[model samples]
Target: MEKKHTIAITVEDQPGVFTRIAGLFARRSFNIDTITVGKSEKQGISKMIITVIGDDRDLERVEKQINKLIDTIKVTEMPKKSAFIAELCIIKVAVQDKKIRDDIFSYAKIYDAKIIGMTDKTLTMYLVGESENIESYIRLMVPFGINEISRTGVTAISKDW
Candidate 1:
């Protein structure tokens, strides 16, 4: 069965690190759902949280290839129960009428979204939640006419010490 996997990787903070990691996924033809990278708690190091949908065998191969990278210091597949995951999305919708704006506001409220930017013809919303929750919001907002969308990808942390 194909399942969502979040892989956490720690690597040295240097140039071309992202390209090297992304190349691994591209070479394997794995569809990357999302990838988030940022500085880690340790100095001179960086962390990456990659979300991909694939079967167990594909995931194993990805892990093995990632391990071969010289910059990679550690790699771990986060367990479902032990990880707290979240993703951020920014969506701009076209709303020319009051009724459409009101309807969008109602839906955003239900999804705990915030109206971050607004203009006469467009409204931009910021949402932070699980990947599934964000997808649901995107589907619901499609009827309102989405003009643009930007996602911050996935970030996860282990719950246990």
Candidate 2:
């Protein structure tokens, strides 16, 4: 069965780290849904969070291959029940009138989306939470006028295993 997997990797902060990791996935023919890299708590190290969809066997193989990479300090596969997943998204919607703008505000309030910017005709909002929530919020905004949408895909941390 295919399902989503959350992977966290601690790696040396050096050039081509991401390229090599991405290359590995490509060579293995794995499809990545999202990958986010940021400075880790430990200096000189970077943490990468990757989300992929695969069967148990394929995921296991990928994890083993990732661990063999020299730059990789650690590779952790997060259990669905033990992971806290989130994504950050910024959406811009066009609102040409007061009623439409107010309606957008109502929706934002319900979703806990913050209005980060606004023009007479456009509203820019920032939302951070589960990918499902963000995606659903986007869907609700679609009928109004989705001008632009950018997302920092699934970044997750595991609860103590």
Candidate 3:
């Protein structure tokens, strides 16, 4: 059975490194669900969190392939039960009427989302939560007219040190 896997990779901070890493996935015909990269705690290094759906065998193969890349320092596949994962999402919704805007605010409050930016034509919200919670918020915002959405893919930490 196919399962969702979150892999965290620590790599050298060099130009085209991301391209090379992504190429490995493409070469295997894997469709990445989400990918987020940022500077790591160590200097001249970066951390990448990638979420993909694949069978256990395929995931093991992918992990091995990633390890062979020159720039990759380490790769860890987080265990589902022992991982604390969260993602950030920003959603822009079109709100032309006052009542609709108020309703949106009410929903945001219920979801613990913050109205970070707003204009007569758009309302931007910042939400941080588990993947499912973010998806749920996006689904609820659909009827309000979602203009655009930006997400930082799942970032996970091991529960045990």
Candidate 4:
């Protein structure tokens, strides 16, 4: 059976690191569901969070392959129950009228979405939470007309428990 897996990698902070990692996935014919890269806690290193769907056995093999890469310092598959995963999303929606705008604002309040920008006809909001919550918010906003959406792919950190 196939299942979703979140893999966290610690790699050297150097050019082409992402390209090499992406190429590895491509060569293996594995689809990356989501990926996020940023500076890690240690200097001269970076952290990459990648989500993929594949069989457990195949994923284990992929992890070993990734670990063999030159720039990779460590690779670990984070279990959902043992990690806190979240994504950041920014959505712009059209404000048709006062009632529509008010409704949007109300929904935003309920979802804890912060209004970051506004214009006579548009509202831009920033939301950070689980992907499911963000999807639900987008669903609710569809009727009001979404202008655009940009999301920082899922990022995760291991829980202390």
Give all candidates' CA lDDT scores.
0.93, 0.93, 0.92, 0.94
What's the lDDT for candidate 1? 0.93
In candidate 2, stretches whose alpha carbon ends up further than 4 angstroms from where it belongs are: none
Q: Please, what is the TM-score per model?
A: 0.92, 0.96, 0.92, 0.96
- Per-residue CA lDDT of model 4 for 14-128, tens digit only, reads 9999999999999999879999999999999999999998999879888998999999999988898899999999999999799999999999999999999999999999999
Q: Considering every candidate listed, which one attains the maximal lDDT?
A: 4
Candidate 3: tens digits of C-alpha lDDT, residues 26-145: 998886989989998999999999998999998888899999999999999987788888999999999989999999999999999999999999999999989999999999999989
lDDT tens digits by residue: candidate 1, 26-65: 9989878889899999998999999889999989988889
After best superposition, candidate 3 residue 132: deviation in angstroms? Answer: 0.7
Deviation (Å) of 25 in candidate 3: 0.7
Clashing pairs in 4: none
Candidate 4: which stretches are off by over 4 Å? none
Error of 2 at 70 (Å): 0.7
lDDT of 2 by residue, 31-147 (tens): 898999999999999999998899999899989999999999999997768889899999999999999999999999999999999999899999999988998999999999999
Q: Model 1 TM-score?
A: 0.92
In Å, residue 20's CA in model 2 sits off its true spot by 0.6
